[model samples]
Target: MNMDIKEIDGACHCGTVRLRVRLSDGLNSARRCTCSYCRMKGAVAVSADLGGVDVLSGADALAIYQFNTMSAKHYFCSKCGIYTHHKRRSNPNQYGVNAAILAGVSPFDFAAVPVMDGINHPSDHAGGPRVVGTLRFVASPGE
Candidate 1:
C-alpha cells in the first residue's frame, strides 16, 4: 500500500448505492479474475482491506451472492445490477472492489492487469505457491 493512499467515493450504475472506500494501494493492486463467475460478468478489481469499505447510502439496494465455498460474498445493486465489491475467497480478510465504480478510476487506467489463478484457487491448496514475482505497471498509452 502507498503511504498516501486516500479514500474515494463510488456508486452503483443507477447512483443508488454509494460507498466510501479507503483504497489499500491507490489502484496499485488492481486485477482481473478469470474464475467462472468473473468470466461471465467481467469487472476489474482493486484492493481494499476488510475495514476500508463504508456503505454511505441505499444499503437496502445492496444484494449479495455467494456460491461454491460461500466464503466470498459478491455484492451488487439490486436495481441496477452493478457489481460493487466482493469479499475475496482467497483472502477473506481483504476485499476486491470494482475498479470501474470508483469516482475517477477506470478499467482502462491499467495497461496490464495480472489475472489471479482463481480457477485453481490458493485457498484450495495445502501450501500456496511459494514464489511471487514482482509486479510492474505500464502506464496506459498516453499516460
Candidate 2:
C-alpha cells in the first residue's frame, strides 16, 4: 500500500499525554495480537521506524509499566491511566503506537492487518507473525 510520510498528532483519553510522531510509510501496516494484555486492552499496534516517534507533550506525565519478561515498557498517562504506546521487547528500535490513542482515526478491520502470536512471544524473533496493514489519519474538524 502506498502511504505518505508525515507528522501525526496523538494523545491519551484525557489528553494528558500528547505526542508527535514522524509517521513512516509502513505505519499503515498494523498488527493485531491475541496476547493476554493486548486482548484485554484491545490495542491495535503499528510500528514506527527507529527514532520516528516523538513525545511532544506531557513527557513528565507519562508512567511506564512492565511485566512478565519485562522487556516491553507500556507507557500510559499517569493522570488518566490510559495506555498510549509502548516499546516492544521483541524490537527495541521500534515503538508500538496504540491506534486508539491517535485522534481522528476510525475503527479498522483486524483481518486487514497481520496477526501476531504475542502469547508465546518468541525469544529470538525467528518465527513470529508479521504485520501487514496501513494506518490512515484524518484531521479532526477544526483541528
Error of 2 at 59 (Å): 1.1
TM, every model: 0.85, 0.78
lDDT string, candidate 1, 67-93, tens digits: 999999999999999999999988788
lDDT of 2 by residue, 68-128 (tens): 8888888999999888888887778778888667666534533355667777676546775
Residues forming the 10-long window of minimal summed lDDT in candidate 1 = 128-137
**Local distance difference test, each candidate:** 0.82, 0.72
Clashes of 2: 5
Candidate 1 segments whose C-alpha is farther than 4 A from its true place: 1-4, 127-143
- Where does candidate 2 have its weakest 10-residue lDDT segment? 129-138
In model 1, what are the clashing residue pairs, if there are any?
none
